[model samples]
Target: MKKLSSLGLLFLLILFLSGVSQIAFAAENPQYGGTLHLSNDADWDTLDPAYASGFDAGEMAVKFYDGLVRFDFSSNKIVADLAESWEVKNNNQNFIFHLRKGVKFHNGVEFTAQDVKYTFERLYDPEVASPGTWVYPMIKGTAAKLAGESAELAGVKVIDDYTIEFDLSEPFGLFLTHLTLPYGLIVNQSAVEKYGADFSQHPVGTGPFKFVEWEHDNKLVMKANQDYWAGRPYVDQVIYRVIPQPLTDIAEFEANNLDRTVVPEEERERWLNDPEWSDYITTIADLSTYYLALNSDFEPLDNPQVREAINYAIDSKTITDSLFPYYVAANDAIPEGMPGGSDLPIKADPEKAKQLLTEAGYPDGFELDIWVSDSSTSVRVGGVLQALLGRVGIQVNLIKNDWSVFYNTVKNGNAPAYYLSWWADYADPYNFLNALYTTDRIPFNNQEINSLLKEMTITTDTDQRIRLSQQIIKLADQVGDPYIYLYHTSTSYVKHPWVKGDLYHQMYTADKLLTWWIDQDLKAESTN
Candidate 1:
């Protein structure tokens, strides 16, 4: 969205010939009184920032919550959000933040350093079982606190009502970057206490928008916060209507009932080539990687040679080539353009694959079941994989499950193989590498990678950190073999010409909606 750097040159030439000014038409001036209509295919999991791990939940969380620090796409850096300013102390091992004054949660409770302390402690709470504890591994007493030996997060110090300090056990280079995630978003203790278990349904935070209503499987609405620390959002209201299908979302957008909708993979080419729709196509190359996960805990796959054989069997370049403009072949663990991202010397070799399978005692190939989520993209990708692996004498049975079943199966390490993607929470190579490799998600255990990942966190030098991460990635490819790197994702959306200041950012969970405003005159003109 920033510059269309990844868009096809031929598409740009088409736009030029058709007299279209930009990929996504944005009005020069903004009008502030319209409701921004949008559609989501699934319902939000939760509104509470701490428990919101799914993308849909995060999309809602960013509207209703404010993290200490947030990604600033305009500058492509981490900028202060709730904290007015911050300073590093004790040789980058401690962070002292000066909080903004007079910020109020949706429930009208004033925000303070106590809220920050409460939020981190809540994340580390053993009873909570939150998925966010990984974001604060460098903090002092993290192990003890998570192990339930300590009640307090000793590192989190409330200096005063308006100031807070975090003492890290080591000098973590991405400390500020980690704080940009929704996990670091501050919440009022009183609000959480009041809602108790229902806190997720009723979120209270000091963001640009306040939660108003949610009709399950229908629509969720948020109104602009009049007393927001920052100025109010340009749009008076933001509405997310749940339209279960991509085709329905596109239909709603065409009917002028929705502001924008994602272009389905099947429909992207037609929309891109059609002169009538080409101008509205907004494509963003995100910091994400889609891959085929081979669970090492499972038999046969546990053999490194078998894993390598599987990798060599599938032609990733060919798959990505067919999905052109939407994706690029992923050569390494880290995505291209990010630090430590590189092109690895890996390719499909049917002969080598067959040789390795025989060496691993699977000469006639073996039956393996690959669980796939019930999304259209995942199913389509699974079919391609089934065909590719069959070529090398490996029979892959595709098991398509709904999101809940697929997620739990993978999380519980029950899936021998699965199709998944990793999108960045922060624009760091560490986020991608640490998430896919270290977690039980894929059950990959590489001592070399594990040690390097630990060192990567505390390494303050940028180049040194990059080198360590790159080494870890290469090791994962050569030895770990947990996943067959597929492709990096690019998302395209059809946006209305009246939508102003909307940018498809790398950090999609950040509050991009606050900057978007509807051009009333243009909307009226288009409607006429």
Candidate 2:
């Protein structure tokens, strides 16, 4: 009896281990290699990670690029990609990264610590005009170089072929986290040399996937990097079909020509109601804020009180209903669940907002042009913002244009006071308020806000510093420099019934694809 009981326990242990092993996809197994088709409503603006600015471009690059550090969206934690392991100096002024051994770029060039050092230095080089330059200011002379005012960035040093040490001039607890920024993604030096201005058009990286080809608006393809340090991807290829219009995306998915497409917001439920399609639909709360950016240097927006008043002018509840129904939640400038000061509060007060505008000398309100992209949803967002301001007596002359022109105008910081857009980068409150508002940081910044942000950078204790950070967050709520606190996005990616497993939409879906697979019955339909 004792022998029989011991044998039973052993068998149960083996069963448990087998289940765990299958879940992690450990040990040897046949690779389920195949191609996947994904479509998005917007086309990628550029493929260069260093210069990729919007979600439209950045998400497309994630299929083929790997950053030194990347965020695990499901866990909201930084995990290694290019670097194997790392440690932060006690003063928060240094981080040493140990690169994985025997890894090579898609172009077959050996990667070294020098590549890491050069990447940051090049980004800080004003001639490159890399938008990621804002992240290197803690490297002492980085700011000057980024502005074309100086020559060298003083922080990066290669200790050896496999190791690199980064010395920050100031401490930032979120520094490692910021390393997950799109601008910090790894690129092939060989490809850049070979492709030149065409590098973006034909890129290469050390990610789990390798770029195959991009046929413009038709399709973009990538194949599995079997030698990937993270292990082989389940699907061998990811083919992105560029479907610019939301309606077109819907029609293609329904017609079965496309395997998957970004589900049109209005048709999510329609798919959900269809049993054949409902099982294929998946939702990931877009940890993104789609809102308007006020050009602080513009006429009416130059007044801080007027900005504060505009914050109270919008009725967000109405916009969320009209635009996305109950699919969104009210959002402050900063995304939810991020570390923040205890003092911050979300705002809404039409009466007080109008009074503040009157005090700012716009008693009869002001006439202004609000700019938006040509996308249908973008137009809807702009129109609602126009109506919200109208309620507060500000007559908004809505100006619509293509996304490329809209982004360029806003980035120049010479926008006509109102421009609508969103941030999908960075997962902290500082990103929304401090990074965007402060001077010497980003495209739209103010010197006064910049002064306060410098202080937040120096405070090391997590809690104490969060207090200083909170002050700015509260200020954002009060003034609404670039936002009136609209709703955060909740979107669905509805696919065909055969589509079983897929990545979620935390804006970093590509990183979590190992867990996804096509249904057994539908596997035959997937094209390689």
Best by lDDT: 1
Model 2 spans > 4 angstroms off: 1-31, 42-45, 125-127, 140-153, 292-309, 327-331, 336-375, 385-394, 399-416, 439-452, 455-469, 478-482, 497-501, 509-512, 522-528
Clashing pairs in 2: none
Worst 10 residues of 1 by lDDT: 1-10
Local lDDT at 6 for model 1? 51
Model 2 CA RMSD to the hidden true structure, in angstroms: 8.5
TM-score, one value per model: 0.89, 0.80
Model 1 over residues 182-232: C-alpha lDDT tens digits? 788889999999999999998889988888889999999989997888888
The C-alpha lDDT values of all candidates are: 0.82, 0.67
Q: How big is the positional error of residue 209 in model 1, measured in Å on the Cα after superposition? A: 1.2
Report the C-alpha displacement of residue 416, candidate 2, in angstroms: 5.5
